[model samples]
Target: MEDNHIHSISSKSACKVTDDICLPDTNWPRLVIVGGGFAGLALVEKLKNKKVQVVLFDKNNFHQFQPLLYQVATSALEPDSIVFPFRKQFNGYKNVVFRLAVVEEIQPTSNIVRTNKGDVHYDYLVLATGTTTNFFGMDTVADNSLGMKDIRDSLNIRHMMLQNLEQAAITCDDEERDTLTNFVIVGGGPAGVEMAGALAEFCKYILPKDYPEYPSTIMNIYLIEARGELLSSMSDKASSKTLKYLEDLNVNVLLNESVSNYDGSKVITNRDNIIMAKNLIWTAGVKGQFPKGIDKKYVVRGNRIKTNPFLMVEDYKNIFAIGDIAAVITEKTPKGHPQVAQTAIQQGKYLGTSILNIIKNKPIKPFEYHDKGSLATVGKRKAVADLGKFRFGGYFAWLLWSIVHLMSISGFRNRLMVGFNWAVSYFTYEKSNRLIIRNFNKPSESKSTINSQPAVKKITIND
Candidate 1:
């Protein structure tokens, strides 16, 4: 086994090996994993020290802790606190290698992955590409609204939020100011609810102190959901509790309402209520994001690749699909498992062992998802949890949520930073990382204007 190395595959080295861009030749079977999310990471962990050459490919160099992305968007935690470098993570794994590349296509017949850099041959391939925000064919909404799917998206939301606040403070037009301050979030899922709560907290605590000129009361937070209840996947008790929690936080929970369209400055709902909001965060839905080359028949609803019981893609034995991109249709889970981190983690670990079993000519076990629980935090000291027969909410659940998330985070430094931030916010209501490093302009705005705009100077808030 050789020490793990991180490489950037070059386009010139597509089919053949070159000095600058080449994977070490080995007799061991090469396992190529596409993605650096929960599943891919878990799979790598399981494959550590195994009789396999593992190569993980991802566009980004870091594995983002997606569960806490809302915290980053709401300025509760910095981006670095939720992201871990791939190289640092797999440092001791001698059999593994990490590559920074965007996978362009999957050639299953040839057992090769075509990336932007080059094409790499593989003995077995794992598709854990994860999910991307689904705009549901609404081009206008997709163009205008911000989606919180990754660190960049979260940072965009934060920048837009602070920029909107600054604009609201300077704008003479009352309607424009209202539009700037009104935060509209589509989808009542955990992300939307958490965002609404965080924004509500910002209105209740941070705004009055930071921007005294603009009344905090003017900053309205709306959480719109087409469904009747929030946390629709959770138990009714959890959903009801989450609704109450959001309401208590002064987050306007607009149930049974769908967004018809979002023009840059206004949100038109199906219920005929027009919301003036410059910042619209869409957490409505997600669809599996996979590269081309797979048969369209294997791609099912939600853009997920259909897989058999062993987590193998339909009609393929060596290629497997896991995480949000995989729809492992079973008798019990006909629609596939919930697109959550746990499902991906478990599936990745299970498939890793299954692959080992295949290599050893042993019986491969079927993948089974263990439902640990579902949890969502609404506001400070307010959350709901559904743990099978046990259902609870409020302060205890909030504490549990915090601890679990803190522990689940990637690194020790990240855990410390996030915990410290949470403590600071809990003890004294303040968001320290609210500095707008980048001036975020509307998507329709000219790129030149965006580039020419001066960066926001740092402001020290006096106690």
Candidate 2:
């Protein structure tokens, strides 16, 4: 068969024409990772000073310590404390390059990735692209509510919260003021529960003294959820303990109900009840983030990439998936493992060693995740931790949670700064850096981002 004959055969076989997926200059092993979050960073760190060329891309230039982002938004921590520059993370490593670009898709057929900046190629591709907020296809919820995902999102929420208070101070109508004062946070997950607590703390210990004009009781922080209880992933004891803690702190906990709609000023629930509010915080749900080029059937529960226990997408060699995007399909985990930082970290470490072994023609070790535990803190002296069989709550739980999170930061400098912020916030009961700077897109940004892309051009990777 001639070259043209093979070309005709290939083109005829598929509906969409893919010319080729091979890299042009494939001299050295080039590894291009799609995310700068937990799993991607872990792989880069583990492979630092190794024998390969590494390139990392993300929309943001900083590696955020997400667990503490709620604190930043609620004025308990500074933005810089929770965010570490991505360049600084790999300063000593000579084999790594970082790019601030939005990944449009991975063209696995062409062995290229299409992005906003341009295309990129790799000998090996890693998909660590993390999850994003899931509104369950609700348009009003998507249109009116504010989400707590990245630093920018958190900052926006803070601005809206404080702005509402300032607005309420001048308004004469009690009903209107009450509407502005109600802060409704959707979801019972860690982010939602933690935000509700921090907001309550602000209302109780800080807001009263700061805003003498407004009554302290005027601040209504509601935590709404669709489940029967908060922290459904944790033990019964932890959930019950957390509920009591939130209630004690004046957090209005609503369970087994959901946000039906938000008309920019009031929240409509499934129970036909409406709560008037100026600010709505969405920490409700998340879905697995998969780039293009893979078969849609591979995307399973939570939109995760269907993968084997070895962390490889089924039937694909040289390409691997990790972090929140990759779902390790197993009988035990029919859907997938819980999407968490620890799970991503362990997978990255395992994959790092496995890749090295494969290079040396050694036996490959399959990746297995170990469930350490989970914790969510609700303001000062109120927290919960579940460590396998053991469970604890209250001040000690808060202490443990703080220590673990601080230590988990990639660099010591970040850990130190975060630790300092925590100490100051503990004593002062005030978040120092509360500047409302930029006005982010009000959930409508997604529409603009999706529309801005080119009409499916062949993306190339310039090595």
Candidate 3:
């Protein structure tokens, strides 16, 4: 880090101490978790009352269920459903303590983790920090586009979409209004597809009732996929069906078309064409959010940390990585498992049992991934499901998808709320909670602060 980039520093430091009372002698085999996402929460949940004392920490105080995050971003669901409070989840539980802290560094040699608040020693560490939305090494994409990783990002996207529609009404120029009304969702994967569908539905049902001045056709929703089809992970028939459903909903599904550039207004794709857009929802891909001090050699494709079949890091005993962060390399499975919540949950269960086995000097079992199949929703009465021998699309698929998701949700209250919301939306063709919150921020509006100039390298908190 360069000194020129350093700002607002204090020359002197203060040290405060209690009544010289010695710190509580921590129990042996202290497990420190860096994140509170899918994998980290699962790990602690499995070992809620185990021998090891668990200290789970995250920047935010909640565990965000990412699959439903797109719905939150598109204003289909409230924030409470997607985000589960970490403390509330572990309340009155023994051997588990949740801490809110920003993890700054991981000193693996010393078996310690540092944070903005303080440092803690760990007998074993689990790096389940999960993955961030991959912008494909494009700086402009990182800076200009809206990422759908966290709740704040989701709410910001929702606000931006609504604000653009409102702004479109007052604008006199038709060109400017069109630009504001148009929305481009990069990556035709499940997140992109869901968002595109929600936005398209908004245009059909919500917009007509609210913005009578703007017709449904005038508000265009474009889904850009670099691949030849959407939901490429699903069956070929499912992909075709999803495309058909999207096309019927009036979403422009642009397949095999890569976006070349986005200057916050015009999104130039491939060559010879450009789409005037306001919102650029980026859900392209994800790379592991590896914590510091892990050996660079262990980091493999997708920036994932390599692990053994036992879910332990290759060169280390005791230390383990799971969820989206760990890449288990095997002859049968090469590219690690898909970074899904279910895989993480299962891995956490296995790893917790494995830890118990290790303590008892018992043989550890290999972690095997169960294929429960994958399903995604495209709006009311529309979805696709792939279950190996069983593959389906359209209305029945949507019902199955809803039931599965509702049952899979973390808590009972959440499942009930989401169920109610879906039921109402299904019947009315309306998505409630479209109200915009917080200070105004838009995807099209350039934040000069983030793009001011070449940031003179600084040793910030992330460093």
Worst lDDT 10-window in candidate 2: 5-14
Q: What is the C-alpha local distance difference test score of candidate 1?
A: 0.86
Could you give candidate 3's per-residue lDDT for residues 1-463 as a string of tens digits?
Answer: 1233223222232222311111223333567777887788878888887666677878898887788888898778999987778878998666677778887777777776777877777767888888888888776666678889888889989888888888999999888888888888999888889888888888888888999986767888888999999998888888998899899988888888877667687676774356777778898898888657888989999999999999988888867998999899998789888888889989888888887667656898899999789898887789999987998888899889888888878788998899899888878976788887775554354443333333233211111
Per-residue alpha-carbon lDDT of candidate 2 for residues 117-224, written as tens digits (9 for 90 to 100): 777766678889989888989876778787787887778888888777878998999888888888889999899999999999888988778789977888888889
What clash pairs does model 1 have?
none
lDDT score, residue 211, model 1? 91
The candidate 1 region of ten consecutive residues with least summed lDDT is 454-463
Ranking of candidates on lDDT, top first: 1, 3, 2
Q: Candidate 1 lDDT, tens digit per residue, 46-106?
A: 9997888788999999999998898898898899999999999998787888999999988
Instruction: Give me the candidate number with maximum TM-score.
Output: 1
Show pairs that collide, candidate 3: none
Off by over 4 Å in 3: 1-26, 442-463
Give model 2's TM-score versus the native structure. 0.88
Model 3: number of backbone collisions: 0
